[model samples]
Target: MSFLFLAVIFTIFTIFTYFKRVFQYWNKKQLPNLQPQIPFGNCPNFAKGKENLGVELAHLYAQIKKEGWKHSGIYIFAFPTYMPVHLDNIKNVVENDFEHFCDRMVGGNPKTEPLHAHLLNLKGTQWRDMRTKLRPSFTAGKTKMMFDIIKQCQDCLVKKVENLGSVEVVELCKNFTTDVIGSCAFGLDCKSMENEISPFKIYGRRALPTTTLSRLKLTFFSNFPRLGSFLNIRTIDKDVHDFFMNLAHEVIEYREKNGNTRHDFIQSLIEIKKSGSLTVEDIAAQTFVFFLAGFETSALLMTWTLYELAKNLEIQERLRDEICDVLEKFDGKISYQSLQEMKYFDQVMNETMRKFPPVPFVNRVCTKDYKMPNEDTIIEKGTAVVIPILGIHRDADYYPDPEKFDPGRFSEENKKKMHSCAYIPFGKGPRSCIGMRLGLLQAKVGLCGLVRNFRFTLNEKTPDVMGLNPGSLFSSPVEEIWLNVEKCL
Candidate 1:
């Protein structure tokens, strides 16, 4: 018993010594940084599920801003991380000096988690090559080709919402986006709008790294990759992996056998696969990412926009008027041309992204030792750098009355006054979101469909001050946003 007790004591002491050294990293480098706590470091709030990672980082950024530091250090568990508080540093990291911070420091064993090999998680030359190849798939011409699919999904959304009198908009938008991404990305009729319990929806919810155990696993993999590799951690749940793999394979096989093809993302991957450049796993991983990103990101954006519009009746009325006028110009049809012409709608969407960006933070890892621009401090290689979009967006300096929902902030004259880096809803630079165009198109279509056809008012059930779900990586309400919807047509 004494030997066992001594062993435990020695193990704990060793861990303590290691973390002590790790936490001293920024201090040794003489960089401005927040002091870290033991074990959890500066992330005890996130670890305890008291706040989401984004909110936690935003609070840290606020502290750094209050101190008037351009940037500050934070610790993700035992790993030393950098948080850029000033817009110039953020621009340097994400844009001007992007080469030094090219990698995102996120990935799993592609052999074990094939779906983890998608563009979002890929690193180095593989990422560059894959991004280049997939570029054409989301080009303006391709988005136009996919507009019809979105139109059909919008029709379904309108039909459903017409009957939904006072319902949760998140669920409604989730269904609409699932069907839209399903048809456009996979040529599958997910029928999420028609069915309450769609399998795609079920798997989609499970696919997000939102649960406590999943978040813990992700944190471990991100901070201590070798340890994660030793344990062979997967980025996806097993069932989600199997579901997408089988679905992609079945579709690819059918397309090959029947020589049937469609103008969709899956068809683009099929053509690549035929050239012997990508494997079945590659196709599955790419399509899975398409489905997951397409559905959730746009759904959350639309839901939040609706929530904001519901709270501000004047803004909703003006937006609806603009949408209606533009649709009239295009013969009451929601077309690519009509959607683009709705300038006010565009501004509203921009402001929505500003206030509640789907990705509240952008993360990258330093690949080479980088000197802090014009400073003697050297950000060592392998350090994680985070840019808190939420903090910058809500900064009173950037946007006057940051808490208020005002689309006029994005007006042509107003946008010119702000620095380019001040607003990065889709991120900025070579490694920015590749599917941003498609995401915007999807969001515009869904929002236009609902706001033009239905009048939405905030239900009493929703809290006046929206609370966020602590577990979600993407921004989500603590609970459903129920809205009272009445058909306007």
Candidate 2:
């Protein structure tokens, strides 16, 4: 009698879940799309982590675009979601109608997920206030103040590359950027350039290790957030959570008690703490995010940039010349002012970001009911809106010869000819990355330092095309980016 009752309950529950999810999409009469399965929706491939979201979404976009649909429907497990494919609609979702669609569709309860308060997870008023306060901290003055830190680390990097001589430095560029961010962001001077177990490197690895177990769990929860929520699924590991929380607390406390102040990110957080308006958990959460954001995202950007440069020698030599000319004015030191003088450096960075945005994909939530531009269709409230940044960036309509690595595509004149919203590696509208200025500063400083000193070539082992690590949220290499570098001077 007990076993029979349990089976009956399971059958009823399964039927209800199917009705709410699987059958709902069928009744909606939504835009045409690939058929969804009972549980995974149109993302069985994504659920298996078999392909990257960017590539997967781009493939979907291509198919929908071919169908002549400017906008299409997708399912995050039978929850009808909006995917903007046309230029006008995508622009409206991000820019013109931003107020109606301001929040990125990231979900986390603040009390349960304290670390989620970090800028990436923050929304609306909280995001605005924190962003305003933090914006000035990344100004040219702040970036310049951190110049010595990057140079010191870059010197370490160059020496490490010099030691490698003719041999390949697998994942060399990523480590170089890691060292740069460590010194600049955390006040931790690390030789990730040479040392495998540098504390900063170890901590970064711990922050997002991309284990098989973690990936599977994340896919399940992200696809079925409501179900996962009810089941008490937690993506952040207890050990990782504790390590970051304790480290952040200790760092902040030591700096406050010792009467120490450096113009780095931690120092800024220290000021926020001293203000007494915010809690210690708030400070620790932001610091943890700063460290993670500073290292992984910027490292991947630099790695992709270096790999592209390796394959394009003419462009590489041109950029190296620009670096030389700019540094010559600053007595051969790469200063903030000197870096700014290299307009070509800005072009190269911009083009690199276009080809390989750190966050290749992003989501926005529709705040109010909104109409798809030029179409009669309305996007109902509570729909998850996905913007395929990587797809639009690589589209041949926007970029001529889309596969070509051409920094000249971003020259001032060429930029003037392009649409204002065409390039969005830092994203767009009011809710874009608050840390954009600092993120760009760190990436440019490291790239400039590398271009000024080393001549890099594609190693025999360099992947034909950069591959994404399946388990990461950010675009990361599945394998290390190997390169052969020689001292230029």
Candidate 3:
């Protein structure tokens, strides 16, 4: 019995020693890295749900930059990750030497979760090909095609706000976006704005990785992919997968059987699929990403924009005046043309995105060994690279008084002086968000309609300095952004 106990102790010790030695990668390479603990690395607070990941990541960037390092390394759960503090290096990795670092390093197992094989999770030539096929679906013309659908949703939002004198903007925006993405992406009327408990919203909450268990599963898959594969871990919940799969199959069959057509994202995919190349899973995956990316991020954008404008009444009124003037020019109608003329509104949206970008950081993997410019160090293949978007946006050198909620910083003349890659709210280069134009259009339309019809003010329930929710993958308000709303006279 004593010998058996000693053997068990030895096995545990050997495992610990292996991981500790693996953690010495940066040390052996003579690279500066943040001190890492046994398991959580530099993300102890994040893993423990005590701090927001975006804010923590920004703090890490600030720490490395303050130390006068162009680039630094850190461990993310025993994984050696590189953080680039300089935009030049960021540009080099993202664009100039794109071939050396292309894939995002995110894990996706088509066998376990076929819907996870969307444009975002795809890598190499598959991603390139998928991106090429989907490009035409999001063009300026295609966005115009869906503007009327968005406008209808905006009308619903206006009615909903009129009925609810005071409400939490996040939930309202979520409902609006649910309807918009439902119609535009999948050609279904979700009716979330009218119905308080829509299936899409209910299933969305269950499927979204916002809960503790879901996030842990996501982290497990991301950090230890081999183990995840062995267990057949799926990114999406099984019930949610079944729900989407059935709905997608139903929609495709109905369209094919009736020969009916609609100018929506799914229709564009159907056209592509008719070419006999893409499969049903491919169609479902792309549409799911469209809904996921479209609904939440755009909702967050509108939420933050309204929150900022509510706090800054002068900016709010100015924007309202501009929105009103533009609509009057188009005969008091919200159209694609009228929305374009609201330039200051656009500036406000840009600033909102800068301060609270939907995606806090963009990641890339070194696909080939590449030497750092003007340095002896070489970033070996398989190294993870992080471009800290939030950190760069808040940098004093880039945007003075970065936290002051200033929209003029995005003015045409002011923007001219900034670095090209410095303000990447939607990221930069070839791998930038394919749905940017659509996102902007939806956000602008929603905000314009809201501002033109109603007034929003911060309610007493709102905290003075609300921190972001640590659980949210996106930088979202920790609590409900309660606001008093009144119809504009």
lDDT of 1 at 191: 90
Which candidate, 1 or 3, has the higher lDDT? 1
Instruction: Quantify how close model 2 is to the true structure by its C-alpha RMSD in Å.
Output: 3.3
Please give the lDDT score for candidate 2. 0.73
Model 2 lowest lDDT segment of ten: 162-171
Per-residue alpha-carbon lDDT of candidate 2 for residues 199-247, written as tens digits (9 for 90 to 100):
6677677666377676666655545556766777666766667766776
Which should have the higher lDDT, number 1 or number 2?
Answer: 1
Give the candidate order by descending lDDT.
Answer: 1, 3, 2
| Model 1, global lDDT | 0.87
The residue ranges of model 1 lying beyond 4 angstroms of the native Cα positions read: 1-15
Candidate 3: deviation at residue 254, Å?
0.6
Give the range where candidate 1 is weakest over 10 consecutive residues by summed lDDT: 105-114
Q: Which stretches of candidate 3 lie over 4 Å from their true place?
A: 1-16
CA error at residue 54 for candidate 2, angstroms: 1.1
lDDT (CA) for every model shown? 0.87, 0.73, 0.86
